[model samples]
Target: MLTPYNLPQDMCMKSHFIFLTLICPGPKDPGKKIDIYLQPLIEEMEELWAIGTPTYDVSTDQMFVMKVAIIWTISDFHAYDMLSGWSTHDLMGCPICMEKSGANWLTFSGKLSYFDCHRKFLPPKH
Candidate 1:
C-alpha cells in the first residue's frame, strides 16, 4: 500500500502521477565526511545514467523510469536493523503530507494499495 502522494495535485480515483523513489541508502547525516566524499562520484554516475537512459522522456508509459539519486555502501547489519524496524505510523494521516486523506493508509502494504487503484489511470490492466 505504499501509495505516494498524487502527482500534479490530482490524486483522486482518477488521474495518474509520477512517482519519485530514492532507492539508495538513506544518508547517515548531511555533514558526515565519508558520505560527502563519496557522494559526488555516485551523483556523477546517476546523472550519466539519467542521460544514458532517459525513461522520463520516453514516449511509452511502460519504459524504465528509475532515476537513482546516488549509491553508497552500508553495513549489512544496520541496513537490516533499519528495514526491520521501519514503520509507516509516522507518515499515515499526517495533515502536513499531501498523501494524507483523513483515514487513508497509502502504504504499499496497506489495505488499499496504489496498485490496487491503478486502473483509475493508465491503460486497462492486462
Candidate 2:
C-alpha cells in the first residue's frame, strides 16, 4: 500500500497534505505493466460493486442494491498509460483534449517534459 510520508519540518504542511491524498499505485520499475498485477484488485472491486451496500429496512426486498458510482482519481500518467490505453510519452497523453505535446526542455533540470497545453470544460466524445 502506498502512503504519504512526513516531509521536512521547515516545509509547509497544507499543500503537502493535499498531495498526500493523490498518491496511487502504478508501474514501479521500468518496462513493466501493472495492469495484470492489478487484475485481482479490480476483480475484487467488481465483486464489491456487485455486492453493493447492505441496508436494513422492513419494506426492502433485497439487502444489497447497486447504487455505486466509482470515481477513479489518478495521476495523468496512470490515466494515460493504464485507464485510457495510451502511452504517456506519446501524442495522446491528455484524455480530455487529446492534444499532443512537444519536447519542453527545462532550463533548471535540463530534462525533457511534455505537458498538456490544451484546456477544455469536458472530455472529448469518444
Candidate 3:
C-alpha cells in the first residue's frame, strides 16, 4: 500500500507572505527513506531562514530584521514522523507515552492496545 508520491507546496506567513515552495516526491510510509529525502529541503530551508526578515518601524522610521527560529508544517501522521524524525513503532515511538521499555502492549477487551501499560514503570500522565 505504500507508494511514493510527489506534490508541489508552499509555506505562508499569516496567510499573506509566501516563503518557500517546491515540488518533491516521497514514500507514503514514514521511515528512513523519507528522512533521507527530506534532508536537502530541510537544509535549504534552514539556510534561507537564517537570513531573517527585514521590517520597518513606522514610529522610529527605522528598519529592523527579525529572525525566525521555528517553522511549523502540517502533514499526515506518517509524513509528520518522517519530517520530524520520530519512530512509528513501539518503544519511544508512541508520542503520548514516550516509553523506552518496549513492553507497553496490553490486552483490553480482547483487543491489543498500545500506549496502555499493564506494569507500573511510570504513571500515565498522557
Candidate 4:
C-alpha cells in the first residue's frame, strides 16, 4: 500500500488512507528478480510523473491533474539489497560508505563489525 505523504504524519499511518498498488505472491523471495514484478508499477509511475492523473478536489469542488513522484522508499535491509542491487553483507555492506566503508572482519567471531565506523560521519563537535 502506498502511503500519501501529504497527509498529516499521524494520518499517514492510518490503514484506511493507504492504497494498495500491487501484490506479488510466491513461495520464495523474488530477490534480484523483483525488478520484473516492479516493471509495471515503474511504468505506471513514469506515466504519472509525465502526464499525471485527473483528480477531484472535494473541498474546492474542482478537478486537477495530480502528478506523483516517489520521494523515498521503506524496506528492510534484505529487501533493500534486492531493490537497490546492493548486497547487505560483507565489508562493503554500508551503502553510504560504499568503498570507504569502515568494516573489519573479526578473526574470532568470524563476523563483520562496524564498531566506531560511524564516528567519521558525525559532527566534529559531537
Number of clashes in every candidate structure? 7, 0, 0, 0
Worst 10-residue lDDT window for candidate 1 reads: 1-10
Candidate 2 Cα misplacement greater than 4 A, ranges: 1-27, 30-32, 53-68, 99-126
Across 1-126, the per-residue lDDT of candidate 3 in tens digits comes to 111121124432234444444445654553556655567766754765788568686778999875444435666756667666777554566575576444445556553344335454656663
Give the lDDT ranking, best first: 4, 3, 2, 1
Top-scoring candidate (TM-score): 4
lDDT of 2 at 43: 72
As a TM-score, model 2 comes out at: 0.42
TM-score of each: 0.21, 0.42, 0.45, 0.73
With a 3 Å backbone cut-off (N, CA, C), the pairs that clash in candidate 2 are none
Per-residue alpha-carbon lDDT of model 1 for 82-122, expressed as tens digits? 43343334433222332542344556756643234334445
Candidate 4 structure, TM-score to reference: 0.73
lDDT (Cα, tens digit) per residue for candidate 4, span 21-62: 767688889888888899998999999999999999887899
Candidate 2 lDDT by residue in tens digits, 25-119: 65553233556665666676587677765655446665545434346445557544765566766455455435544436678987656644443
Worst 10 residues of 3 by lDDT: 1-10
Per-residue lDDT of 20 in model 1:
33
Q: What is the C-alpha lDDT of each candidate?
A: 0.42, 0.51, 0.54, 0.86
